[model samples]
Target: MSAAPRPADVVIIGAGQAGLAAGYHLRRAGADFVILDAQQVPGGAWQHAWPSLRLFSPAQYSSLPGRMMPIPAGGGYPDAAHVVAYLTDYEQRYRLPIIRPATVRTVRRAGARLAVESSAGTWHARIVVSATGTWWRPFVPHYPGMRDFRGEQVHTAGYRGPEPFHGRRVLVVGGGNSAAQILAELSQVAQTTWATLRPPRLLPDEVDGRALFDLATRRHRATLAGQHPVGAGGIADLGDIVAVAPVREARDRGALKAEPMFSRITTTGVAWADGSAAAFDAILWCTGFRPALAHLAPLRLRGPSGLIGTDGTRALAEPRLHLLGYGDWTGPASATLIGAGRTARQLAGEITAQL
Candidate 1:
């Protein structure tokens, strides 16, 4: 038999940047809260990122609330390992109450409190903050005969490096940063083809995450003030891609060109809508991810669009629940490091007021 549910005033799901930021605030407020993390280690999704991945912003801009991330020794954009080190330090610095390897199974109403069922145990809390990020839920769009493709197929989540595809023909799908970065690296050693639904919009060389975050902040403020914000689309209005060093290098090498998305997959490779086909040894899908809200399914809060309606961070159907770190829908730029910290500050203040 299972033990009785442990109690907390607040329960925050996930231990990534968003959850850590929330925990920092709630701790400062002296709230009785606990963070439940699915990962056994401190670094959340960063620990799983490809080894060569680098942040679009500098270390300082990608920091949590209490402490700024130290610039990497080499002084370029921090890589995945640097981020992992920073996160591990941040967790230890704050001494936040975190339960790891505690994969939450479901969150359901139990009297006045919500019961969080997890691999670790059950926790009953007055408020539940779902800060679970979307890294685990990779999305790969279906194409005709996709299942019939005999070539190796891999998604962004499973990708590690390009060495495996060396000297081979590889097809890369999607036009986002991941697709660009991965294609750039693979182009160094492999013959790569880029596929996109539309032509990619590359931001100016000077534009980066810091500029995008500032724009998002201004737009968020304008929205709060009930004004029609100029440049309301934030990063989308600027461009779809950031020309990081490697990407620019690839562009200079004439390897950054994109082709229209193929219509179907074949046993050997893929066929374009124009009746042309190409053979590839591997197909890398950098499509995207959806919100990781499977644990909240018991609440039935999602609508037909598979999204939970929210006023800021609070769920419309259940006031006791607040979703964080998913994306702009939860809070403007909330998925980013600084964005998550800013949103968590507001969310913790609101939750503190209730307590």
Candidate 2:
């Protein structure tokens, strides 16, 4: 057998918004840690977002812990490229120790510590923070005869631009910001159909991320005070829709209407409950993603919901391991750029206390 590797104080997985936020805090507290990112380049999941995708919040509102994202010269929400550039700059500014293309394969108990198996090598970590968000795990619900459908299917994760879809019949599915934004753009190019489980909740045009965060904070406070709170759910619940320009334009153009989900996939098209069928050249699954927790599968800590049991960011079953930015279960609005900072600060404090 080989010699044992020296243990790190903490090992963070994914160099995205969450990992970067955690790094910001840990560095502030003078902690020794390393971040492992599967992507070779900077900007974690933002690198994969579609070209036209813009943040729901402004640059000032969508910043990490230490540094604020610089607003554009003109004025508007920063798009994916701008966010990616900000992330790259943030990493360089802080000089956070991050290993690139080091894909973590598994993590398991190693006596007093945990052994992290990755493409780079085995890392022994006293504490591990899994910040790998849901971009890699796009969820496409199964429908009857889906396997037999001859047309093309692509998840939003794989979607690049809409030029190739010009003149094609496409179905956009989901009720979130992504679905709305994509449906808006796609409608401009392709003959599109928007499908959702239920009609989407559109926030008032004036409502934005700041308003949403404030509302969520109120709900959280109310919940702690032993009161029943209204609108307690996903960041989407705060303002299920952001009235972006393209989406608003689509609405005005009568292209933003959404219908209930189809009953099944047919060889030639999708079938409705009313026994009607509509042919489509392709289906774009805007359905959201599950957490990328396969690396923790060996821990067997996941519940039926495929979520690790957690008290705040700390794993309930494995105290040494903390999960950040997977979803709301890890922290309030933890998945967004601004939200990651709060959770990262709290988790850093917890880890510091333990250390």
Candidate 3:
């Protein structure tokens, strides 16, 4: 027989912002836990982000528990590198126990405990926190003739910079911040087309991640207080896109306008319902991602919506499993830096009580 699984009070299945935050709180609670990271290095998905990608919030606003991310020396929203550095430092500063390149294969019930099986080894724990975020699972919608397209196609996850697309005709799809930001930069060097399912909603210049986080916090507090606050929809009530500097500059240049999504893709380009067609050299799909939860498949906790029903972060079907940082369903804005810290604090407390 193989060696028996290691034992711990908790096993956090990610070392990204969410997992790190969970580790911080669990450590303070004095729980025995280990963080399993799929990536070989530190920084999580942030390390994979495009060099120019920036956090919409300033350093002070985007922070984890017990440590504040240092403000960028140039004094602006920190770039991906800055965030990566902060995360690297945060894990070291706290001495969070992390096992690298440990891709979790499955999480299943083992007697009264949950068994986490990963490349690094198996761990049996009383609780498992799934903080594996969505960056790994890029979502691309299907279109007729998509496979027939002759042009190069890339997703937000694959896009690095606009240097390669210079002088080429490029189609940028999706209407989220990624699409807008990427389009803004790519348009400068390439002939660009913006396509969206509907009109893109642009937030005023004053609105940003900080404001959105504050709104989410108030909404969360109101719900906890058992009060139904008016206009409780939170950030969704505002708009979709934040007017970052690059996007605003692009808008001023009349490059931010969006066209209706094409009905189908052709080998040459895309065609609209009206029969009009445009040819492009390449297509960039700024489409978003799905939660990276395949490792939890063995648990059979997902509902018809392909999501686990959760009472906050606690899975309804498996209370021993807590899903963190997937999105608001886990906790309002839990996918974000500040939000992860807040939610992890509560989650750690709950697990600590049981431990």
lDDT (Cα, tens digit) per residue for candidate 3, span 1-355: 6778999889999999999999999999899999999998999999998888888888998999999999999887888999999999999999999999999999999999999999888999999999999999999999999999999999999999999999999999999999999999999999999999989988999889988878887787788789895357666589889888888899999998899999999999999999999999999999999999999999998899989999889999899999999888898789999999999999998888877
Compare the candidates by TM-score and give the number of the best one. 1
Please give the RMSD of candidate 2 to the true structure.
Answer: 1.5
Encode model 2's per-residue lDDT on 238-325: one tens digit a residue: 4578887777888888998989889999997799999888999999999999899999988889988778899889999999999999
lDDT of 1 by residue, 209-320 (tens): 9998888888888888999886977777999998888988999989989999999999999999899999999999999999999999999999999999998999999999
Order the numbered candidates by TM-score, best leading.
1, 3, 2
Better of 1 and 2 by lDDT: 1
Cα TM-score per model: 0.98, 0.96, 0.97
Better model by TM-score: candidate 2 vs candidate 3:
3
Off by over 4 Å in 2: 1-4, 233-239
What shift in Å separates residue 66 of candidate 1 from its native position after superposition? 0.9
Task: Give lDDT per model, in order.
Answer: 0.93, 0.89, 0.93
lDDT of 3: 0.93
Q: Which residue window of length 10 is worst by lDDT in model 3? A: 229-238
Whole-structure CA lDDT of model 1? 0.93
Angstrom error of the Cα, residue 216, model 3: value is 1.9
Candidate 3's TM-score reads 0.97
